[model samples]
Target: MCNSVVLGVDIGTSSTKAVALTLDGQILGIATRTHQVDRSHPGRVSMDGEIWWQEFVGLCTELSPHAPGGFAAIGASGMGPTLMLCDAAGRGVAPAALYGVDTRAVEQIRQLEDAFGAEEIYRTGDSYLSTQSVGPKFAWFRQHDPEAYAAARTFHMPASLLVHRLTGAYVLDHQAAGQCSPLYDAARHRWIAERCELVAPGITFPRLAWAGDRAGEVTRTAAAQVPGLRAGAPVTVGTIDAWAEAHSVGATEVGDLMLMYGTTMCLVATQDHRVRHPSMWGSPGLVPGRWTLAGGMGTSGAITAWVRDLLGGSSYDSLTCDAAASGPGARGLLMLPYFDGERTPILDPSARGTICGLTVRHTRGDLFRATLESVGYAVRHHLETFHEAGIVPRRAIAVGGGVRSALSAQLVSDITGLPQQLTRISIGASYGDAHLAAGLLADTPPLSDWNPVVRVIEPRPEPAYDELYRLYRQLYESTRDIQHALAARHSASAGEPLPDHRATATAPERSVTAPERSAPVSPAGPDTPRSPR
Candidate 1:
């Protein structure tokens, strides 16, 4: 029975990870595949939905040998509230539009606000119309790609896409549904059919279920395509990767903030009552009777990876070591980590990355340290919003690959003055998915016991960080107009229309093309969806 274990998989922005684990929380094997997002045009980020299933098959195939006894159950997760419209037969109509990072729906957001008063939209959706909301993307499709919208009979996020492929189930978790802003009624915990019809006419909403509930059993056809799993193995209705990561670290209690350090930085603060703010997102928690206030930065580890690549693909360890030596404030360097535009508190899709106070004497180390500190300031901005909303966190838990760097974690702690709790396992959302799968069994152990707090990252006061943060706030305001103008120029040069409702109406007719095939999988492995964790 040692080989009989539950499986968990998460499709993230930059990679896909899978893990096999015993019911008692012992990991048998883990696999990860890193891939890049497609950015053929400015403000557009997407991935082939087919890659999500392909990576799942690859990961399961790689882990199958280690689990000789056979699989017990499966749990799935991915970066979301993404928009992947599909036909009635379940094939993707187009490449999946990623979460907030893809900022092509600005006009759609405004249209929704105008149609449904902003106040009423927030009252129903628990959030304002921001890039993070899925509703605007739906509107964007209807307005821009009428053919695709006409063909789309269903919508799927990464988790639901995998679930449908595995179990032949057409369903989405309630937590994911809540993020569909204006289309979902947070108070009622269900889709608002009227609003759905208004934004995305002629679409069918998937059946809704709790994140941990069993979605369905693996169909015989799916079992044959993927080795080591028999037909009828239970599959849980998985949720957004960040929420699953939150559950993995036992961060579901009121006043517990789960800070995820990954491709993008995300924060999920559990609360007893729903709290609505214009800048942050509010959604139903993984379980009933709980709510979460969430916020995310557009770039975190992504910027560091960019810097590494720019410096001829040096090892991250070397970069971290050099960054540590650069000391606080990065020797008079400050950066705005908005390479993909900003999200949360700022919500500016036109914002571009800015580097201030650069000198020829400064090394790559100083630039890298400034990048890390930039994320720290962003974290502070989000946490300050939480405080203003009267949702101060009693405990802040940090997880993901970025947490491995003491320099980065310390910078966040120093900026926020909040101690960060580190768990024994930091494999990320995949570990959490395994825990959720195990819960379906009657004999599963408590999740808190599965992964315990290994250490606490305490803040060492740094006066320089305070002064730098002040400048960070001012930096964005001072450069807003220039960034907007440059963003417009980039769009024009790319032949991409600026956000305008009339542009789609007046644009020349073009034949609808099928989504392009995903980039060939690298020798190392396959890829998955987008967003922070």
Candidate 2:
């Protein structure tokens, strides 16, 4: 008998990827479609909801032909916790408001904090409201785009949105819901309806399920639209892409940290019990009774891409080679990797990227190396916070496209002084989604057998790196005020309102019902052409 197969698709920040694999872990086929967030406006980053479904369909068309025996189940994951408000018919009311990288909700964040005490939110949700929380984004939509908000019957993240289109089920994974903050009660594992109403009045949340639970079977309409998928195949309720990426490398064990180096640098540390910190996020794990402490840098690989493009589209291979040659400290250069503000630890949206120590003699290589080293410093900063919160990881697994670069991974290890295990199969979250789907079967093989560690990157302590890291921290503190002022100027020039940091709690409470129709405003920006992930 032929081995059964499962398919997994992930909508990422810069691309959509899919994989078809058998129950025993052989990859049958893989496909990817690149896309970019629309960033035509400062502090606004998003993508059309239509692009997600179209790309999923495109991936299915490309991979389905290779899966001759067909699939037993289909799983999906994506960049989240994003806010994609949709009507009852599942049409997106507006472009999705992306995660922490899009810092357009600063005012709304403060508004929600005042309405519900910040400490109470942290105590109940196990996380503080920041750019990452979906609650604030909802408030931003209601206040800024009342027409869309009035039409929006429900809100969906990338994962949930795709699941709804595929299975005709309006469901969200518990892990994703936990990131909604104030709207979701982490301990209770359910929506706090009253609190949700405070931010998203009259909005109905989708049914919640574990990431691995079967959300529903593929509908005939969806199957026909997607070409390769079978109508009756079971679909797993997928979670955020970072969690799936963690599971991809078997980094789900307690005290294991999965550092995903993608468009955004994300860190997920597995914990047996809830570990809450004001800076980091605490969410339910892929499996029940499991928990995770998470942090993400607003940009990592994104910064590298920007530098590469600015240098006239140099190939990444050439850039990496040049960066590697630049050596430790990038020749006295230091960079704060806050190109899109920052997420973890500091949680400052007004923070801006800054580079120090420039010279006329500096080459593009030096700039590239500085960018890479800056990400390393940011990783160390987050790891230090993990230690301070008493949630240190015993083992670290590195996964994502960035791991293909030895210099990048080694720099991270050297800076953090932690051994990072590299898995043989590092296709990332889509592969993990397939693993989760396979596990839904009775006779699935162990995940360990599927993906094993091929090599370990041990830290090479360099005194120069240590000194640079110390200065990297100081540089941020010394220049934070300057960065904020620059951010304010950028916002003003873009005709964007600066966040009212000291505004009184006098904002009028608006009803959920539709009011007078004003000029249509795009919350993020116009749909831009697709770009590479």
Candidate 3:
């Protein structure tokens, strides 16, 4: 096929997207299907895996006519630490459990802390988990839903499970798998049979693959469900979507870091070697032999969205502009973006959000401004660990849904006093997946030759920023005790025991005894058994 294109499929919490792109960085077609996350309770969130797969297949075909002769390469990207169960037939045995924000696993969290000493855990990887961790979710499953647990044969992330359905292969990427902390060992690059036994005993695990490894081709039958894709398109097992975005933004070189300002503010740095932060994840990113020093703010743009939703308007532009006008430090008001809960630094799953030093004189604009600075403050928190470990990034690549406004980017640069570069492919992971797919296929082309930076934000250090950042550091350290106290009180009212630090590493999950529960359910209704693809 002349001008061969690569297809990228990005499966996310709220939607599934696919795109058609040329090796020369030309976008030929794109499609997205929105899906709602079921949040029936304060601590529960899930999606039906069956629905995700169907939507993905449906969208691919819908976008196919936009690119002629089909795509020559295909790569997938997805959210990480996403846990779900499948029956032997490969159908989702139940709704998929999401990561980063799900809080039902608080009980499991307590159990983990009891088993793995906090000091030990911090030393190993500083990866303090939230209800968003995959391990505890499994533990919760085994304790509360014994039957479902007994029937579940394998525990897999959403993306790997999707690949299994499409290619009939049982495979996962290192980045995706690595996020399955306490299940997959980042240092060893293998499933820690012992830890998995302690946290999720007997749950079957998928075969592992490195980022960018070939995961087999799309089946002709599966291809029929999605349009514009050739059955034999080379499919590469992909990396976590965040990692994919970092790659797409050209944050692959050493010393260049990416700060993703989306639902959350995530930081990922490209380093020649693995650098672990007691509060961050140090895993292999997109390139081999390179470490991505990664961490995230539990909340970022979400708070901004919250303010708008609260104000009941499309006044986001006004709010941001107003915040910009109100000046630095928001008149001494500070916000803690733990509305849903926290992850990095303060890994407290039970922590509640806070807004300290609110005054009658402070307008909503000032609060909004403080909220923006809070997000940047968190960036500083995660970055402090990087700095302590000697992982010096020259600057950070700012990407994601949050960088649309010039003022927002400028605010971040000002807060951190670091240059923030913005790239052209703002669609992020989906675009990154296309780049990966194209680079992998012999018929496709290279990334450096294609995707290039569109603009860069130079550091504009402000006089007030130094003090603002200092106050930001003090906020978390000073208020953690109160946050936990709030969590305990809330837990007592709900009749649930408060989670303790001991719960970060050890909780029990079960195995699937029933054939249907052995693995993820495939398409065609997940009722049949799985053989090789």
What ranking emerges by TM-score with the best candidate at the front? 2, 1, 3
Q: How many backbone clashes does every candidate have?
A: 2, 0, 24
In candidate 1, list every pair of residues with a backbone clash.
Answer: 13-530, 264-532
CA lDDT, candidate 3, residue 190: 60
Instruction: Record all residue pairs in model 2 with backbone atoms less than 3 Å apart, i.e. clashing.
Output: none
Lowest summed-lDDT stretch of 10 residues in model 1?
524-533
lDDT tens per residue, model 1, 1-533: 44468999999999999999987799889999888789997788999988998899999999998666557789999999999999977899988899988888978888888898776877777777778889999888887888888888888999999889989898898789888887887776777767777787778778788899889998989888898676888899999999999988998888899999999999999987777666778888898767888999888999998999999999989999999999999999999998988778677787889999999999999999999999999999998888766778999999999999988998999987989999999999999999888877646666679999999999998888889999999998899778777888888999986664221221112221211122221111111111110
> Per-residue lDDT tens digits of candidate 3, residues 11-109?
876678888887767888888888777866556677777776787778777877766777787888776668888765567666778876777787676
Q: With candidate 2 superimposed using the best TM-score fit, by how many Å does residue 467's alpha carbon deviate from the native?
A: 1.3
In Å, residue 104's CA in model 2 sits off its true spot by 0.8
* Candidate 1 TM-score to native: 0.92
TM-score of each predicted structure versus truth: 0.92, 0.93, 0.88
Per-residue accuracy of model 2 over 401-430 as CA lDDT, tens digit each: 999999999999998898999999999999
